[model samples]
Target: MQNRPDLPHSAINPQLVWTGFMAMCVGMFMAILDVQVVATSLPTIQSALDIDPDQMSWIQTAYLIAEVVAIPLTGFLTRFLTMRWLFVTSLTLFVIASAGCATSSSFGGLVSWRVLQGFSGGTLIPSVFSAVFILFPKERQAVATTVAGVLAVLAPTVGPIVGGWLTETYSWHWLFLINVLPGIAAALVALRSLPREDINTSELRNLDGLSLVLMAVSLASLELALKEAPTSGWISVYIVTLLCLSTASGCAFVWRSLHRTRPLVDLDNFRDRNFLTGSILSFVLGIGLFGSVYLMPVFLAFVRGHNALEIGMTMLVTGTAQLVTAPIAVALEKRVDARLLSAAGFTVFAIGIAMSGFQDPRSDYDAMFWPQVVRGAAIMFCLLPPTRLALGRLSPDKVPDASGLFNLMRNLGGAIGIALIDTIIYTRSEPIGRTLLARLQAGDTDAATFIGVPLQAIADHKGALDQKTMAMLDPLLQTAATVQALNEAWIVMAVLTGCAILCLPFARPVAPAE
Candidate 1:
């Protein structure tokens, strides 16, 4: 075995390591939070920048595509540059990019800055995940993972509220400006505290340039294809071409990786049964986690006519529940079989998703509270176990690459899950709206009630309603249809999450790594 240059336990300083670890967590949190934050305030950004509605989605897509490409490259970068240098450099660039984003006056300028932000921010997740194993000993790893996992899931949960408050109180520029101070402080702390090792420059000389290109092409094209698939029909030539490019490039990258002694991404990580099953579970959890987050805001803003802050305030229940349950989850993780814990977590989470699926047009804060609580309470279990199952058995030197692949699964799952949710909403809403409209035309009072029109307004008029009255009701009908469509998307994700449990049996039991 090669003698990796990890810091020895005897030389460790408890205070500095903890400080550095916390700094890395902050950086990771900021990165993950930016996605949801921007999502919540995108309308404000679009209006302020005078961006066309058709081009508005590019702001999010460019960031995401850049992120997916950067994730798998973390392992190689870590090896070449060392964790400390990689993190500090990435965070510094991220902060600069955030500032750039805030000052941009045009759509192209904002998108360019966002791409830089995404690539830099994308490295933070796997870096923190890798730090867990590198920085902590066996007994402390579970606690470390629990802390990291809590923050990882918590950021997205709280993002909408944060974004909403900032947009309402200040302006859209504050959204990116918020990261500047904290990011700088984290970079300084990490530079001083994180362990340093001699850089391996030889890795750069041996780097497979072709494999790198193949991966970038595959991931970027796939992300673009997913972004367009809902708006453009799946059978459309542009989408089909992108999908083919992604598939062919992905296959070539995998083959080349397996053949190399030092591949950019370690494809061999998937050979471990526990890791493989855990990655699958991570992907499914992403669907439920990211999909649920996307579903709630849409339901609130469009269906219930809530503003950004109100949407955030209403969904705050989930983050509150997660915080309350963190200690209990941490305790259970130390005593429980991870597979069983994961199974229980996914089951409870599925129930939460399904509960929201049954909601009507009238569902509001009170109606959503318990479901959010259920899902939030289950989040730690969902994250902690799969993380341990996947990376626990790997060697010290291998953890970085393995961590990249592990984290990438969840992000990929999220991208695909959001795309699917949008497809269901876009294609099904018009048809569903027409059906409800037909029922109302036939004098079905139930349809009127579901669409939230007054009994007195439509009851006597019945089939003889005037054009003005019908026009007034059109928006309401459309909203109700969207709500139902959102519910269907929720149910689909719930079923997908529930089926993830059956795969749990395949994961080998994980004991804490030595």
Candidate 2:
């Protein structure tokens, strides 16, 4: 056979390459899907488990913290366990954890299972991207990456829709139960097909125990503070203590990573301008991506009085738009300037999210449609190209480390983003409550009318009805306040996204590697 160095390389067997690729995508889909799918049924789960509404946020927070903490260590885990064994172990652990979550009768038990699920599920995400760089030839990287990108965006997009239907029709347990079959099948396919690598136990010799400890503590405390900040008071003793400790630990973790020889994974990737720029975009992408997802469901279920099924069906619009844009994004990736694409993506996404800010109290399926479409179309351009900038053309040896760090930034951004928005919703509503109550106290008839307090009788029955008006008006006012807060949060996201344009110049185009 003639050797042609310039010709596209088919380095691995086609059957194994695609089978293993699809398997990873399935695992990625299942894991990402699990997070979003259960989001809608959270209220139902809280009710069923008899969990306190105050601590219910922990259900999502625990998983996010565990998942994010595991992300940067992916390079380490991949070194110790090949993609094949890692996926197998992670899939197995994920399946077991899902089953445990479904059957758990207590809050603690469910949360414990979720933590394990997060750690295992975390590995699957970066591994899918790592696989794209390592498994596919440069020529086909775009197509393969697009497939993974589609699943990543698609799963979350459909998650609530599927979750709402399942929870409304069957039970909340079905959210976790749905993962078992697919998880098992993905594991089986990956086990049979993925090419194996020898475990590199030598990579852990220095371990950097302090970095690992500090990393875990830092991430955990940060997530806790975010989750509790809204009600507990952002500057309260508990929130402040957690934030202070997290800051100390995070500073120490960075110091240890920079000074230590074999840091957990490379923090050095950020020194690269393109990598750093791409990372910042990824972080903002997380805020918009996870923030929008989190906000919409709450807005729909809580404010719009929509059921689980309706929220899910509406969310499907984002996913559907993503499908439409995937090919265009991939095509443009080759011909267009990457930094421009990123700028355009963030700009387009910001506009999309801003569209959501105009939502009314009566916002419904039709009202949310255009915003989801704009966001969905913009998702591909936001995700795929930055991925290339962050992970593309790296030394094969650096691929794992780069991918791990890259994905970690996005997830961490999401965890923090969720907390900020939660704080926004909690804090913003309280003032509105106080302000509205004051209006009533000042004998403002509009306040009474707003709450349907029969303003006609207010003057005559001022003494009797003042107390009654407060009681009647509280829930109605609270709901309005929440809608106002969500609108503010959407505007904030749009502004944050616009700021990503500042990071645009650093994400310069990387020419295709010959």
| Model 1 C-alpha lDDT per residue in residues 1-514, reported as the tens digit of each score | 1223445755688788889999999999999999989999998999999999999999999899999999999999998889988999999999999999999999999999999999999999999988888888767788889889988998988899899999989999999999999999999999999887777798899899999999999999999998899999888999999999999999999999999998999989899999898899899998999999889988898888898788888888998999898888778878888898899999999999999997779999999999999998898889988888888878888889989988899999998999999999999999999998888877888888888988778777876778898899988888889888998999999999999999988888876332
Q: Pick the candidate with the highest lDDT.
A: 1
CA lDDT, every prediction? Answer: 0.90, 0.83
lDDT of 1: 0.90
Task: Determine the C-alpha RMSD for candidate 2 after optimal superposition of all C-alphas.
Answer: 4.1
What TM-score would each prediction reach against the true structure? Answer: 0.96, 0.90
User: By summed lDDT, which 10 consecutive residues of candidate 1 come out lowest?
Assistant: 1-10
lDDT of 2 at 235: 90
